[model samples]
Target: MSLLVAWQLKDRRVLIVGGGEIASQRMDSILVTDASIAVIAPEHRLNSRARQLIACHHARITHHDRLFLGPSELHNIDMVLTALDDPERSREIVLMCRDARIPVNAADIPDLCDFYFGAQIRDGPLQIMISTNGNGPRLASRIKERLQRALSGGEGEAITKVGRLRTLLKQKAPGIGGDQGRRRMKWMTRLCNEWELEDFAQLDNAMMKSLLEDGWEKDRIPSLQDVGGTCSTRRYHQNFHSTIPLAVGFFVGVFTTALITFFRHRK
Candidate 1:
């Protein structure tokens, strides 16, 4: 099976060989990241959409108004995508990338591909990817559509808001490999489990600050009834409340451990 990974593409250099609709679609996906893109294909061969992508993202994208010349083009490139109509040329680029030790995605050429784009769902910073391992892309697309339909937009919003909370938590806890970090992780994990998706979605700046405050001083995060922002689905909300006792027990265990460590160190 394929080992799926979420690659960090920020400020990385990526080379795209071809300027067709398919190539442009691949380009669109990366445009969401901070990658420096290089598009290689004759200016005359570029489709309208491809041309538009270059025009809009000229600062981020470098368009070469000519076809892939040789191996020299692969220099300093971290990744490559070949979506060429010319099978021979696509194969050539794939082989070249392989020689240069760069991961490559070869459209319609599964055997040559080091990676597959798969079917992807994006909810701000949260991403869910479904891959059939080059078996059925059409099936993957259908699955993605179904999943997207099931998600409330709140799923994305909650993640975005929680991410901001994490940033604030870093200031209180500091380095990620010490006692303070351990406490921070346990506290964050407790919040994520005890709070429902709806609960997280409703968090305002004041509520988040209150959460951090409670964790630090009071050692208690309040119930949704006390906070009054969400719990829109009664059935799911009830289910979540049922699990809170167990979650709280876990947090309490963590707190007890921290206290024991502190007293032991002091003695």
Candidate 2:
């Protein structure tokens, strides 16, 4: 299985080796991050949208209006994306990237890709990425659509509130080691588990700030039980039950050890 991770691309340099629709789409995706982008393709070959995007980010993006040279151009680049129509040119770029130790995503050719750009659902600090191990992009897109719909109602606001709460806790709690850090982590995790989008949607910034300042009093915190059965509680219980066999085995091992110790003392 391929290990998935989120790469930090802020202020990093990325190279795009095509200027067509696929290249434009890839450019759009990378633009969301604070990466310096360079597009190397013939000036007249780029689509209008691609041209516009490049012009819009002229300060951060540099357009080379020519075909890619040898591996010399790969120096100092963190990643490369080749959306070239020519399979031979794409392969050449991939080989050069591999030699330079740079990760690459060659559009439409899974075998040449070091990574796949999966469909993503982003909502104000909350992001969910869906991938199908390079087997089904369309299926991933469909799943992303369903997830987007399910997460649409007031979730953005909820995530914003949670983010604010976390910042407040960090400022108040300060260090994240030893007893203080563990306490803070426990408090935050419990709050996240119990709270839902509906609960945060009704809360104003002032109230939330007050809750933070007051150390999350029992009366101040909203109870999921009052609003009917909580899905979070059900999920927690389900997880607990699933681990019962392991828990039983652990207890049995401890009991057997204690019994052997008692018999040795008697002898």
Candidate 3:
């Protein structure tokens, strides 16, 4: 049940109805987007992080110095998030949002929320969110940590470079979905497979345009060096395969040690 989606919040208004750590975290996420944010809570209730946001992003965010005033406060609000310690008050705000047809998420109150903010890993053009569908948020966080370790840091820049290449394709071979789209997809896939992560990470503007002009448009894919890329994919595959023997040996040693220790204890 992967129901999570990347909502387009650019220029949309998001209302947060608390001033605690949970609310601060959700507001941190919104700050990355072009969303207009307004937080409602008494000034004294604000945590240190919440106060820091107020001090830093003063121009970008508006924080009301009082408690939520009901649906009137939610006027023109596209989304609502409530992280109040008082569940009753939070629930009341949720009800108001529902009445006004606004999407809402109530922190730690699964049944009242229209959405949940899952553990997330964010890079330039890459965002990975792990959710347990209102169950096991700790596990979701552990999974996010594991994924962060698995990915190479070059990915963010690589994805950004790929986007630049896509933009160039649209300019050189412009068309709105059809054969042109399919052709673009095929070429993009080819590059993703053949080019190493470092190649994309280091793809300069001049090299990017030249690659498209000489390689794709010319109907002749040139040598890797011509556009400053290496065929390191095969080398990486070889390196991965070479580690299998060492992994097997390490696991076998662990199993044998466990068995010997168990038998000694039995004796």
Per-residue C-alpha lDDT of model 2 across residues 115-161, encoded as one tens digit per residue = 88888887765667998887788999999888876553566667787
Q: Write the per-residue lDDT of candidate 1 for residues 62-130, one digit (tens) a residue.
A: 999988999999999999999888889889898899899999998988888998888899888778999
Please give the TM-score that candidate 3 achieves against the real structure: 0.84
- List the global CA lDDT of all models: 0.85, 0.80, 0.85
Candidates ranked, most accurate by TM-score first: 3, 1, 2
Tens-digit lDDT track of model 3 for 1-267: 558799998879999889999989978989988898999989999999999997899877899999998779988899999989999998899899889999999988888988778888888988888998767889999988899877767778889998998898888899888998888888888878767765686678878888898878876555557887665454475588769998999999999999999999999
- Candidate 2, superposed: residue stretches over 4 Å from native: 201-204, 216-267
In order of appearance, the predictions have TM-scores of: 0.84, 0.77, 0.84
The ten-residue window of minimal lDDT in model 1 covers: 226-235
> Which candidate model has the greater TM-score, 1 or 2?
1
By summed lDDT, the worst window of 10 consecutive residues in model 3 runs over: 229-238
In candidate 3, the residue pairs with backbone N, CA or C atoms under 3 Å apart (3 or more residues apart, or in different chains) clash, namely none
Question: What is the clash count of model 3?
Answer: 0
